[model samples]
Target: MTALSDAEFVVRTVADTACANEEYFGQLDAVVGDGDFGYSLARGFEHVLAQWDDFDRTDAGVFLQKVAQAISQRVGGTSGPIWGTAFLRAGGKLKGHETIAPADVVVALRAAVEGIQARGQAQLGEKTLLDSLVPAIDTFEAETAAGASTDDALAAMAVTARTTADATKELQAMRGRASYTGERSIGSVDAGATAVAVMLEKLAGAWPQR
Candidate 1:
């Protein structure tokens, strides 16, 4: 069973990372977007942190649902709905479970991915977060099935995220505001994808303990 504490730690890590790298994410987005990506994410997650203790602890699903509420209500533009949907779907997948298992982890992640796709109307190679996120989750599932320790799985995920995020430089922006930049978006790394890499790297350093 995955401890509630562990889930809390991961969510908190994601929020902190988003807040800390606000400028960096904005810079990435500035290459092809309006440059508000970082600011939006940071503000949304800050609200999540502010409401941390008030979140329902009925189960992992309910807890994440509360998180989704906070983000959707606080964040602006497209980011709020997309990011909130991810947590909400993940939480839904784990609903009723006071704890999560490795298999549950897989399903929850898959659900989150699906939610992102539906909400963002994005697919792979779109030069979005999914570019990194999908590959990283694939690595995560493989490592878990191989009986890797949590640290090992997280390590692989970090590497995959960083690698895939960088690889987005080779793909044209096919979605989001970046798509409006046309061929000009091809040369820059995706802001959302890089953010995913950063978040995974943060998790790699702190997993096992949480």
Candidate 2:
């Protein structure tokens, strides 16, 4: 598939997954963090789906640029900027690419991780989205290096993302509103990390190959 198609699939899958787990995230966030994560993600991705008709007509980079802009404008709170930056960085890395190779997927994922880190200024073990994204990227890179296809690499990455997100329950929050909970934040999965894992799973599921 073309890079544009891959991005479109990723966006649609993320939106769908977020919609499916909206209430779960809301309840999770209501306990230790702001309760807007689910609503914000739903709204942001709703806007993304609304623009799907335009995706195939545009270049991959331009399509993602538009998605980033739309999400930043429509989605409220930290998710807007963090998710927007992730797409924008991935789009930047995909510039001028028609079809995305396995290596291209690796580069795009690395750019996404870097963008999230730069935007949130949070690192691994901080109980943020990085906990999921960083390990997922690492797994994708490792799989690619091991001669895996794009589909296989993404599948491995999805598993790593989910595992890392679940492991966040043992971590203390170091950023965002969750940080205020101090030790109370421990034993609760980071909503953002869970959301990232959800997205990764959705993307892997949507992959054309099994």
Candidate 3:
């Protein structure tokens, strides 16, 4: 059983990843964006981690809702609202659950993907975070449906996310500031996609099942 405490660890792990990669992400964004995504997300998650001890984390829903709230309140730019909505929608699906099972995680991930799509009005192959996140969730759901353990499913998610993020370098930007760069964006990775990949990879590593 994955407890709320375990969820905290995953968030903390992602926060650590965000902080460690902030400069790298900033560099990625510098070519086409305001170059503040890394700093915004790092500070937002830092705030969430700092207040984690005071959150009502008896269940996954409450815990995730608080995390969503922190991101929305502390982070700026399109990434904040999009990420906040993803967490908020996903957490809503897990309401009333004291512990999240592997199946519950599947439901949450689906909701998160849907929320991100709805909020961003973006789709795969658009060189956004969805480029990485959608494939990871699809791989995870497929693996789990095929009788993979939580560990294996999560591992697949991490691997797929990383690969997808890297592949973004070959994709032309179709959204956000990067879109304005046209072919210039093709050789550079999407900063948002890279951040999502890092977070997913770290979360998989911190999973209780691992």
Clashing pairs in model 1, backbone N/Cα/C closer than 3 A: none
Worst 10 residues of 2 by lDDT: 51-60
- lDDT, candidates in the order shown: 0.92, 0.84, 0.84
Worst 10 residues of 1 by lDDT: 1-10
Using alpha carbons, what is the TM-score of model 2?
A: 0.93
Q: How accurate is candidate 1 locally (lDDT)?
A: 0.92
**Regions of candidate 3 where Cα sits further than 4 Å from its true position:** 208-210
Query: Considering every candidate listed, which one attains the maximal TM-score?
Result: 1
Residues 52-109 of candidate 3: C-alpha lDDT, one tens digit per residue: 7887776878788889998899888887888899889888988788777777877887
lDDT of 2 by residue, 1-210 (tens): 677777677777777888788888888777789888888888888888887676544677778878888788888888899989988888888888888777787787788888888988988899988999889988988998999877888889999999999999999999999999899999999998888888888788778552
Q: Write the per-residue lDDT of candidate 1 for residues 79-139, one digit (tens) a residue.
A: 9999999999999887788667677888998999999999989999889999999999999
Of candidates 2 and 1, the better by TM-score: 1
Ranking by TM-score: 1, 2, 3
TM-score of 1: 0.97
Residue-level error in angstroms, candidate 3, position 3: 3.7
TM for every model, in the order presented, reads: 0.97, 0.93, 0.92
Which stretches of model 1 miss by more than 4 angstroms? none
